[model samples]
Each structure stands twice: as C-alpha cells, then as structure tokens.
Target chain A: MVTAREEILERLERARPPAAARPAAMPEPSMPIDPMATLRDRLQDAGGSLQFATRSGWTEQIQWPVEATTLRHVYSSLNAMPGRGVGLSSKTNHDLADLDVCVLAAEFVVIENAAAWQRPGCLRERAAALLATHLIVVANATEIVATMHQAYARIAPSDASFGWFLCGPSKTADIEQSLVLGAHGPRTMSLILLSD
Target chain B: MGHRERAREFVADVDRTRWHDQALWFVRSKRDQAADLVPDWEALRDQASAIKRSALTELPELWREFEEHATAAGTVVHWARDAHEHNEIVAGLLRDRSVRHVVKSKSMLTEECGLNSYLEAEGIEVIDTDLGERIVQLRGEPPSHIVMPAIHLQRAEIGELFAKEMGSAPDLDDPTELTDVARRDLRDRFLKAEAGLTGINFAIAETGGFVVVTNEGNADLGTALPGLHIASVGLEKIIPQQKDLAPFLRLLARSATGQAITTYTSHFRGPRPRSTQELHVVIVDNGRSQLLGRPAFREALGCIRCGACLNTCPVYRRSGGHSYSATIPGPIGSVLETSRDPATHAELPHACSLCGSCTDVCPVRIPLHHQLLAWRGELALSGHHPAWRRFSLNLVAWLFVRPTMYRLLGRFARGIGRRLPPTLREDLLPAWTRQRHLPTIPKSSFRELYRERQRQPKRPRPQAQPRPRHERNG
Candidate 1:
C-alpha cells in the first residue's frame, strides 16, 4: 500500500518544475541612522510607548499601579525591577491573569516594527510576557537592529525553543475599522531602552 | 447558488453594502500608504516571488529535510493527505492526551479541515483565541475576512452575541469594552485548555522550525500554557532557509493590515524544556499537490493569505466575503476554489470585472486576473454554461468577425432605440436594463471618426526664426 506521504511526495515531484536561482537580497540602507530613535517612532505609530532611562531610573519610573482591580506587579528577572511585587513563578497560570504589570528582559529589539524579542529560557513562565495587563520590556540600546534581516542575522536556530517578536500592545481594527488595543493580550506595552 | 445571486442578496441592503465597500477601501488605502514607505518595495516583492518559485521547485527535498530536522529536534511530524485525515490526526492527538478543551489561534488550514466540528463531535471543546475569530465562533458563522474574520459584523451585533455567550453587560456596544470581555473570558480558556493549535505562516527547512504571526498575542499565549502545541501547516508553506522570512515578514502585515509587523511573530523551534509541553506539526496536502499539477494555475500556491487582494477587490468589497462561500474568498480564493472543483466554482471565475487591481496589489505578484481569465476559458470548454447564454455569445462572436455586419448591427440598434417605444426598449435587454437605462448611441463609430480625420487636409507650419548669437549662448 502506498502511504499518504509517499503519494503526496510523488505527486509533488511529478509537478515540480525546473529549478531557478533565488533572487539577490534586498539592498539595505547605506546611510547611518539611530536604530533606537527609529524604534521609538515606530512604536508610537503602532500605539505603543518607549522611554529612555538609566538602570536606576527605570526602577523608579514603573512603580505605580495601573489598574484598580488586581494591580500586582510581576517580573522574571531579579535585576532592577520596581517595587515589592509577586514573582511570575509564585502564581499559577490561572492566577497570572490578575497581573497588571510585567517586567522582562528582551534579548534584542527590531527597529522596523518596534518588536522586542523574548526567549522562554529567560522568562520564568512563558505566559508572563503575554498574560499581564501591561507589559514592560527592558532592552539595551546597543541590541537594537534596523530591520528584521539584521535581527535574524543576530540569532541562530539553536538559540531557544520558544521566542517571540512582540511588536506592540495587542491591537485590532476588526469592528467597523475602529483601532482597539488590548484585544486578547496586553493593553499597553512600554519598552525601556537602557544604556549599557 | 452562483456568486451573482449571492452577491445580489448581500447588496439588497443598500446601507450595509455601502458601509462594507467603504470599510474595505479604507484598508486598501492604508496598505498603499504602508507599501509606499519602503524604499525597496518593488525589489522586496520580486525577491519574495522568486524565493517562493524556488521553494516550489525544491518542495519535496526541502520538505523531507524539514521533517527530518524537526523530528530530530524533539518535535513529532505527521502527514495528512486530505482534510479528513488531518482532522483525524489532530483529534487523535487530543484524545491521546485526554484533553477536554483546546484553545486555537487563527489557523485557516484548520478551518479548511473543519477541525472544530470534528473535535466537537469527539466530545472536545475548542475555543478560538483571536478576538475576531471568537466573535464569529460564538455567533456560529464562518469568518467573513481572513485577516479580520468578523469584518462584516458591527460592534453592536458582537455585543449582543457576547451578552448571550459570555454574559457581559446586556447593552454594551463599545468595541473596547467588548474586546475586554472577550480577553478576560478567553484568558480563562487559555489557562484551562489542555492543548493548543495554530497555523504555520512559514516553515523553515534549514532551521527545523516554523513562524506564526498574529496581531493579538493569542498564539504564543495559548501554546505557552498548553501541554501540547499542534501546528497545522500546509505543504506549500515551507521556505528553504530562515533568511527567506525577511521579505515575507516585511510584506505580510503591510499587505494585510498596513502594519510594519504584527504584534507577535513567534518562532517555535521545539517544545519547551523540562515540562509536559510537546510540539506536533501536521503537514497537510489537502489537494494542494493536485493544484500543483496544473502548471498554468500553480502560482496560486505562492499566496501568503494576506488578503490585500480582497481589500482592493471591488466585487469582494461590494458583495462581502460570504458571497464567495469558500474557506478563502476573493481573487486568490476564486482561483484556488476553481482549481479544486471547477464545475462547482464555475461562477466564481466570472465574478470579477477583470479590473486587474488584485494583480497590481498582490505582494507576491501572482497573475490573478490572468488566472481568472484562464478559468473562464476552461469553464466554457467544459460545456457547462447555459445554452441561451452560449448561443448569444456565439452570435456576438460571429458578428464581430465581420466588421461590416457588426457596424450595420450597431446602426440598426441605434435606429431602433431612436424609433421604438420606451417599454419596447426596456424589453430589449431585461437583465441589464432592469436596474438602469441604456446609454444613448453616438452619431458615428470611433473607426469612422478616425478615418474621416485622416482624410482631412493638414495645415502648413510657419517657418522658425533663429535666435541671436548672444541670446543663444546665454
């Protein structure tokens, strides 16, 4: 009996046309520009906020509670996260919904879409970056890339099993073309660019 | 029903039809704005098209390499020949895990397989996490648009649906509030569901991984909490290298929603470590190979499902996505559906006005209008058209072959229009004249006017005067 895979493969091979050389890479901008500024502008356009701060200043900046109901702060890193709050590991996935603010370290950030890349190895729970009402990603200024091509060049396939490019707060223009943020993910996303 | 009949029913509501038209036009304008920002936009499109062409040629080899690498990376791989097998494999996976509930991100492939209905029949509950998808799921309707599934629905209708389904405030119609209610409700489902399912946007053969891009973070969130993450990938989604994602990622969101990128573009290499989570990818052919066999229509597989063509299509915008009545609807949908069952989808190829806007707006540059035109030829060749229509078309073609007869017929029609009664004129062409009046005929044909101009005498030109040396030098 011919397996489904074999049948499918045979059909594909029969249908396959002669091979052609792939096109050359798209030319990158040759001019010098600040990737951090570009990232901040892109974030603003996408309904997200960005701020530059020192390590000590970022801790003082995100100290306030955002929502009246369940404003618990959560963080994966033990570094300079603000205020006394519950850690991501302390709560189960069910209770993580009550989290208002989450502070996580970004491996790198892309300027083209203002996306901050996060890895499962760094975050205590993978859901923390997504479950919180408001998300705050901490990234170094030197780690930003001007485009997705540059971003992909920085990482390899073996880096981590789960990684994401979180561009902005969850948004949707579905209902009558009205732009609404926080559809099913964080309502607000803020990126803090820390100078190394 | 034919696309025209369905479209007539949709446009019967004048106000709603106008609203749908403007809303999609607004999205198309946004896409234009986004495309204009990239300095190398055309270059990127060419690169993406070429890359997809190469991928199609190397499909079997690259698919084997992907399966091997993905399997070696601790991810299980399965092959499904059709929708039935795809649904069975997914249902069996859920059954083996004893999963009562599964949360799904937006995966059109699963929709093609009717996976939700299949799983529900097996006593499993499936919750869609994307806000637009969840609204339609609760309303027991298929998605109207692929990117924005509930684009045909207004917030007021969604509020009523949510009030019944999730028990929100009875009179709530605000989009922000409705989105919040869905977010809270789906958050619970995400945390409680035992398994997660997503559709692959692009699967990389070199990296042994796949990517899922969504404006909402539902895909990442759902897979994060579940013990099993099942990605239903079509066989054509495989790209040879990770770097090929650059052009696709740049074009996808821009073409779909005019964004530089989706909110989340998550790459899943394997299951997470030291946990119960596992990754299982089902590579689904589901008639795609059959589509590949036809060289004339094979380029349809290069579609990335961005729905830019739908947004720019006058027919789709005026009639709405439901008119097509397929899993995908619009130019790409029209081609893909006709390729599957030409007889059933015969009306779809004839639905377009041959405007060619879809061809121009397509990021991968698929010759959509040409494909639709080709389908029309095939459909006509199959002898499936109505006798009267075919006879009328043949009569017209015969007249066109003899120019003198054609011109005489045109003059005869003009004379009848001038001499006949209004009722008789209306009866001359009932189908076209039902909605509007016929245009008044001109005195002469353009060919006659051109010949007359050529026969007239030409005026002589005056002699030119030369400039002074100093002025010319200056």
Candidate 2:
C-alpha cells in the first residue's frame, strides 16, 4: 500500500501544469529620502516609539515608569546594561512570565514598516520578548534598511533557529475593530537608535 | 439551506445588515489609502502572481527540496491526503506525548479539518489564543470573517459572553476593558499549555522555514513558551525562495487591514536547540490537487488568504459570512467551496453581483469573479441546478438566437406590464422585487426606438476647419 506522502506527491505530479520559465524581475522601488525620518514616522503610526541616543547615553534615556526602580525585573542582553539575567538552564519557559522589562539587540530596522529584526539565541530569550511588559530594542542607526526586500537580503534563515520582524508592540483590533495595545504581549515597544 | 435562503435571514435584520455593510466598507477605504502609499503596487501584484503561478507548476520538486532541507534542520514533516488524515496525524502526535492542553493561534486549516472537535473527543483541551478567535471559540461559533473573526458581533454581545465565561462585569462593554479581560485570561492559558499549533502564511522551499504573521503576537508567544510546536499548512502555501517573501509580506497586512505590516511576522526554521523541543509540519492536500488540475479554476489556489475580497465584496457585506456556510466566506470562498462540492454549493456562484471589486483588490490577482462565473457554468452542466432553472435558461437561450422572436416577446411583455397595477407587477418576481422598486415600463422597446431614429434624417457632420500651413501657401 502506498503511504500518504507518496500518494499525495504522485497525484500532484500527475496533475501539475507544464513547467514554465519564471518571469523577469521588476526594477526595485526607490529608497526613502531620509530613512531615519521615515522610520520615526512609520513607527509612530504603528503605535511604537523611536528615539536617538549615543551608545553611552541610551540607558539613561529610556522612559522607565516611576515605580520601576523597586519592582521592575529588567533583563538586558546588551553589553552596556548588565541587568539580572534569567536562569537559562531552567527546564521550562514559565520562569520568565513575571518579567517586567526586556532589552535586546536588533540586527537591522526597516524604514517602510518600522519593523526590527531580532533573532533570539535560545527559547528563553525568545519567550522573554513576548512575556515582558515592555520590550526595548537597540540597533545601530546605520543598519536601517528602506524596505522589507532589503531586509530579507541581509539575513539568512539558517543563521538562527528563531527570528522575527516585530513592527510594534503586540496589538489587536479584534473587538469591534477598536485598536487596543498590549494584547497578551509587551504593552510598549521602544526602539533606541544608537549613534556610537 | 442554500446561500439564497440563508442570505434572506441575514437581510431580514435591516439594521444589522446596514451596520455590517458599513463596517466592511470602512476597511475597504483604508485599503485604498494604503495602496496609494506604494508607488509600484501594481507591479508588485504582477510579480507576486507570476511567482505563485511558477511555483504551482513544479510543486512536487519544491516540496521534495523543502523536505530534505527541513529534515536537515531537525524538523519533522508529515503529509495528509485529506482532512480526516490531517486530524489523525495531529491527534497521534499529541497522544504520544500525552499533551492535554494545546494553545492554537488562528488556523483556518484546522477549522476546515474540524481539528478542535477531533482533539476534544480525545480529552485534549485546545484553546484558541487570538483575541477574535477566543471570543468565537467561547461562544461555540465559527469565525464570520477570516482576518477579523468576530466582526459580525458587537461589543455588548462580547461583553455578555465574557461575563458568562470569564467572570467579567455583565454591563461592561468598552473594547479596551474587554480586551484586557481576555488578555489576562489568555496569558494564563499560554503558561499552562504544553503545545502550540499555528497556521503557515508562507512556507519557503529554499530555506525549509515558514512564516506565521499576526497582529496580536499570539503565535509567537504560544510557540515560544511551549516546547512542542506544530504548524499546519496547505500545499499551495509554498513559495520558491526567501526573496519571494518581499512582495507578499508588503501586500498581506495592507490588503487585509490597511496596516503597513502586522505586529509580529515570525519565521521558524527548526525547533529550539533544547533536547525536548520539537517542530512538526503537516502538509495537507485535501482537494488542492484536483483544483490544480482544473485549468479554468486553478488560479484560485494562488490566494494568500488576505480577505481583501471579502471586505470589498458588496454582496458579501450585506449578506453575513454565515450565509455562505463555508470555512472561508466571500467571493473567493464561493469559488473554492463550489468547486469542492458542486451539488451542495450550487447556489454559491449565484450569490455574487459580479461587481468585479474582489478581483481588483485581490493581492495575488486571483480573477475571483471570473472563477465564480465559471463555477456557474460548470454547476449548470453537471445538473446541479434545479430542473426549473435549467429549463427556463434553455428557453431564454432559444429565444436569444432569434431576433424577431426576442423583440416581439419584449414588446408583448412591456405592453402587459404597463397595464398591470404596480403591486401586481412586483408580484411577478417577488424574490427580486422584495426590497427594490421595479422601473416603470417604457412605451416602446429599445429596437423600436432605434428603428424610428433610423427613419429620421441624420444630422450633417460639422465642416472641418482646414489648418493654415505656410508650406502650402509657399
């Protein structure tokens, strides 16, 4: 008896249309005039914020809530901010559920949609980005791209086990099409553009 | 019941029908604004369409390449011949691991396979994590719209549901407060779930990776926290290369909800490096192979499931999604459903006004109206249409070939129509004239007016003014 995979593949091969040459690629769209300005505007439209700071001053510029000093649990993977790290050897990801703030580094940012490409190294790091109340991503200002096409060309899928293009904070318009931020993920997403 | 009968019930509620229509039109207007921002929107659509068509012709080789690469990346891949097989495979995996609780993002493919009920029968708790999907799941209802699953329900109704299910205030109706209630409740489910299931938006054959896009980030959280992840994909979701993702990612959110992009577009190549983590992909054919074999209707397989066709369809707006009674409900749904089971869904093709709006807004340019029209012909030929409708259509066809007979019948009908009272005239076609007024009958047919105009003298053409040329004078 034929297996399901073999049967399905056989049927597909029999029913497939005659192979044809792929179409010629179209010309690329022009890049934005000012990538930083476009990224700021688009990020604002997506309900996220963008700020510029030097590598030395970026930590001071984050708008931490007034109560954050005593109760906040900050997890930073960057070299500048050496916050307390979660136990990576934990068996499950549930340990990071109480995290208040998480700061990671993005490979590049796209100007057209204001998405930051972040590749988390492990399962716990990836879960922290979603489980925390606030997500802050820091990237070099020179790494910004004009569109998704340029962003894809810079990265390979095999380079990371998990990767994501996070545009804004988690949001939903599911209830009567009313825009609501902070739907089961980070309430706010802030991107810090480092100059140094 | 058929689409016509189900649509009548929806139309009976005049206020609700009007509200639904306006809500969808608002989204359509937003899509137009988003399209205007892109300078090469049409060229992008052409490129996406060409890429999908090219991929369809060589699906066997692409899937083979995907399997090899995915296996090397430590991902397990499965194949299902139909919905029943798909359900069995998913259930078997969960049963082997003793996974009692699973959190799933919005997966229309699972809805098509009836996976929820199938898993529930095996004593597994499957929770839908998307905000809209969770609402409908609690109410035990199918999603009315693909992108906005609960668009048909109002805030008050959702509030009442939450009060009953989640212990929220009975009178609370604000969308923000209600969403918060759900967010807190779903976060608990996410923490408890042992497995996560999602649907694939695009599967890259070159990378052996797939993308799952969402505005809510539920797919990411659901999969990130859980050690086991299973993704269900239709065979047609395959694309050739990673660079091919650019045009599709650009158009998906803009065409769906007028967003520049979804909040989270996560790519998964393999399971996490942890020893306990696993990633399983089920590639199901169902009836897609038959659809691919059909030359006239094959383009419907190119759909990216953006739901733009549903938002822009005038008929779909007035008639609620429940009227179609399919997992996907709109212009594209009508084409796909009728093709899958022609006899049962014979009336679906006639549910269109053929305004051609759906085709204009389709991200992949599926030519939806043309497919719907072709379904009509196919159904009629297969004897799926009623005998009376077939007979009447044959009579009309016989008369259309004879010019004299057609004109005489038209004149006779007009003369009789003019003599009858307005109410009596409306009674002749009650289905068509129920909510619309019939136009007043003219004294003469169009052919008669044309003949009389031919007898009158034609107006002389205005004399052309000759151009003054220096060369001619010289």
Candidate 3:
C-alpha cells in the first residue's frame, strides 16, 4: 500500500511543469543614509519607542514605574537590571504569566522596519517576551542593519529553536480597523540603544 | 445563488455597501503610499515572481528536501493528499496527546479544511486566538476578509456580541475597551492550551524551517507556550533558499496592510532544545498539483496571501468578501475556486470588470484579471454558463461580423429607445440599470457624422516657413 506521502509525491511528479532557471540574485535596496534615524522613525510609526544612552547609563534611562510597588514581578536576564531570572532552569511557560516587565538582549536590529531579532535562550524566556505587560529589548547602536536581506544574511535557522523579528508591541485593527495596541503580547515595547 | 444575485443582496444595504467600499479603498491608498516609499518596489515584485515561478516547477524536489531537513532538525513532517486527510492528521495528533484544549492562530488552510469544526466534533476544545478570528469564530461566521477577518462588522455589532459572550458592558462599542476585553480573554486561553496550531507563511526548504507572520503575535505566543506545535502549510508555500525570504518578507506586509513589517515574523526550526517538546508539520496538496499543471493558471500559486488584490478590487470592495462565498475571496479567489469546481463557481469569473487593478497591486504579479478572463473561456467551454447567456452572446457575435446588420440593428434599437418612456427604458435592462442610470442615446452614429463632413468643403493649409541656416544644419 502506498503511503500518503508517496501518493502525493507521485501526483506532483506526474503534474510537474518543465524546470525553469532561478532568476539572478535580487538587487539589494540602497541602505538608508542614516539607519538609526530611520529605525527610530519606523519604530515610532509602529507604536514602539526608541531611546539612546551610553552603555553604562542605559539601565537608568528605562522609564521604570514611579512607584516601585507597581512592578512586582520583573524578569530581566541582563545583569544591569536585576529581576527574577528564569535562567537555564526548567521553568514552564505558564510560570511567567504574572510577569510585569521583561528585559532581554537582542542579537541585532533591522532599520527598514524597526524590529529586533530576539533569540530567547529558553522556553520560559521566549514566553516572557509575550506574556509580560512591558517588554524591553537592549541592542548596541553599531548592530543596526538596513534591510531584511541584510538581517537574514546575519543569522541562520540553526542558531536557535525559535526566533522572532519583534517590531512593535502586539497590535490589532480588527474592531472597525481601529488601531489597538497590546492585543495578546506586551502592551508596550521599548528598544534601548546603547552607544558603545 | 450566483455572484450577481449575492452581490445584489449585499448591495441592498446601501450605507453598509458604501462604508465597506471606502474601508477597502483606504487600505488600497495606504498600499500605494507604502509602495512609493520603497525605491525598488517594482524590482522586488519581479524578483519575487521569478523565484516563485522557479519554485513551482520543482515542487517535488523542494518538498522532499524540506521533509529531510525538517526531520533531521527534530520536527516530524506529514503529508496529506486532501483536506480530509489533513484534518485527520491534525486530529490524530491532538488525540494522541490527550489534549483537550488547542489554541490556534489564523491559518486559512485550517479554515479551508474545516479543522476547527472537525476537532470540535471529536470533543476537543479549539480557541481562535487572533482577535479578528476569535470575533468571527464566536459569531459562527467565516472571515469576510483575509487580513481583517471581522472587517465586514461594525464596532457596535462586536460590542453586542462581546456583551453577550464575554460579559462586557452593554453598548460598550469603543475599540480600545473592546479589544482589551478580548485580549484578556484570549490570554487565559493561550496559557491553558495544551497544543498550538499555526499556518506557515513561508517554508524554507534549505533551512528545514518555516516562518509565520502576524501583527498581533498570537502565533508566537500560542506556539511558544505549548509543548506541542503543529503547523499546517499548503504545498505552494515552499521556497528554495533562505535568501529568497528577503524579497517576499519585504513585499508581504507592505502589500497586505501597508506596514513596514508585521509585528512578529517568527522562524521556528524545531522543538524547544533539551526538552521532550514536539513540532509537527503537515504539508497539504489540496488540488494544488492540478493547479500547477495548468499553464494558464499556475502562477497563482505564488500568492503570499497578502490581500492587496482584495483591497484594490472594485467589485470586491463594493460587494464585500462574503458575496463571493468562497474560502478565499476577491479576484484570486474567483480564479482558484472556479478552477477547483467550474460548474459551481462559474459565476465568479464574471464578477470582475476586467479593470486589472488586482494584477497591478499583486505583490507576486499573478496577472489576476487575465486569469479571471481565462476562467470565463474555460467555464464556457465546459458548459458552465447559462444557455440564455450563451444564446445572447452568440447572437451578438453573429451581428458583430456584418457591418450592415450591426448598423441596422443599432439604428432600430435607438429608434425604439427614443420612443419608449423614461421609466420603461430604465426597466428594459433592469440588471444593468438597477444601480446605475442609462446614458442618453447618441443623436447619430459616428459614420453619419463622417459622411456629413466628407460632403463639406475642406479648409486650406498654411504655408511652411523658412528655417535659419544654423537651425537646419543642426
């Protein structure tokens, strides 16, 4: 008996068109003259905010709640802002549901669309980015790329089990096309650019 | 009912029809703005089209390569010949894990296969996490628009539905407050789900991975929290290389909603590292192979599901997506649905005015209006058109060949048209004049005016002036 896979493949084999040559390499769009400025504008358009600070002063620049009691459960993997760390422990994704703020390091940032490439190290860390009320990504100023083409060339699929180009906080315009920020993920996303 | 009948029903609500048309036109205008920002927009569309064309020719090789790489990366790959098999495979996976609750993001493939209802029949609880999809799912209706599923609805209608279902305040029609209600509701469902199911946007054969794009990040959150992830993909979603993603990723969001990019463009290679988690992929070939074999209609496989064609389609914008009554709506849906069942969807091809706006806005350059035109011929050949329509068309064709007969008939029709009362003339072609007024009949034919001019004397021509020597030499 032929398996489903075999049957489908056989049908495709029978119906396949003649092979055609792949087109020449896609031409790269010219890089923006000021990538950081472009990234800031694009980020703001997507309902995200961008801030700049020196490497040492970046932690102080975050707009932490005026009342410390408001942020009860903060999850930060970076050593600069200490919080409850999931680390390499076997923390289930549900354990992070009540997370207030999540701050993690981004591998790089893309300028064409203000997005940070976040490769969470553990399952809990990955879920934290979505479940938290506020999400912050820290990236160096020198690591910005101009387009998705440049971004893809920098990373490989094998680098992590899961990765994402997170632009703004999750948003929806489903209700009569009215833009609503914070649909299912963090309500606000801030990218802190460190001037190294 | 045929498209014309359904469209008539939709257009009966004049205010709603006007709103729907303007809403889509607004999105189309945004797309034009986004396209203007990119200097190389046309080049990207051409490159994306060529890459997809090349990929379709060797799908067998691409899928095999994808299966191998995915398997090697600790993801299970399954194949289904049709929608039924696809549903069964997904249900069996959930059943094996004893998963009572499953959280799903927007996967049109699943909708096409009726996966939600299939799972529900098996006593499995399924929740659509996307805000738009959940609204429609709760309302027990299919999505009217691909990008904005609940676009056909008004905020007041949603407020009422949520008031009844989610226990929100009555008459609370504000979008922000209503979205907050759904956000909190879906978040709890996301945490409790045992499995997550998503649809693939782009399946990279070389990397043995897939990418899912969403603005709300529902797919990411749903899949990240659950131990088991099952992604359903159509066979046409495969690409040959990783670099090929650049052009597609660039065009998809800009064309879909005029965004620089979606909020989340997630890439999943396999299960979570060092865990017993599972990642399963089901590749479905539901009439896609047959479509690929067709020379005239094969390029449609390149669709990235952007919905730009829908936004720009005058018929779709005015009539709304539900009028088409197909899984996917608008110009592309007409082509795909007619090819699958010509007898049933024969009216879909005639739904277009052949303005070709869809082809111009298509990110992959599918030439949608041309294919819709071709479907008309195919349907006519297959005897899908009504006998009366065929008879009338044949009569018109016969009259068109003979100039004398054509002119005589034209004169006779004009004479009758002038004598008829205005109301009677409007009622003569009720279908055409129902929503429009007939133009005033011409006083005389163009041929009569030409003959009249020939009988008159011609005016004299002006004398040529002499040119300077330097100008002449140059």
> Which residue runs of candidate 2 sit more than 4 Å off their true CA positions?
A65-71, A85-91, B416-441, B461-474
Residue pairs with backbone atoms closer than 3 Å in model 3 (clashes): none
- TM for every model, in the order presented, reads 0.93, 0.95, 0.95
* Each prediction's DockQ against the real complex: 0.73, 0.81, 0.82
Docking class of 3: high
User: What clash pairs does model 1 have?
Assistant: none
Error of 2 at B178 (Å): 0.7
lDDT of 1 by residue, B175-241 (tens): 8888888887987788899999999999999878999998888898888877799999998899988
Residue-level lDDT of model 3, residues B78-136, one tens digit each, is: 99999999999999999999999999999989988999999999999999998999999
lDDT of 1 at A140: 85
> Which regions of candidate 1 fall more than 4 Å away from where they truly are?
A30-36, A61-71, A82-91, A122-124, B415-440, B459-474
In the order shown, the chain A TM-scores of the predictions are: 0.86, 0.91, 0.92
Model 2 agreement with the true structure over B1-474: per-residue lDDT tens digits: 877777778877888888888899999998898888888899989999999999999999899988988888899999999999999999999999999999999988999899999999999999999999999999999999999999999999999999999999999999999999999999999999999999999999998999999988899989987779999999899998988999999999999999889999998998877558899999999899999999899889999999999999988888889888999899998988887788778888888878899999999999999999898888888899988779988999999999999989998999899999988876554131245578999999877899999999998889998878976777
Q: What tens-digit string does per-residue lDDT give for candidate 3 at A1-196?
A: 9998999898889888888889998666667998888888889888999988888867776665334456767788788877753423326768777888888899899999898998888777888888888888999888988888898889975677788898988899999888899999888888988986
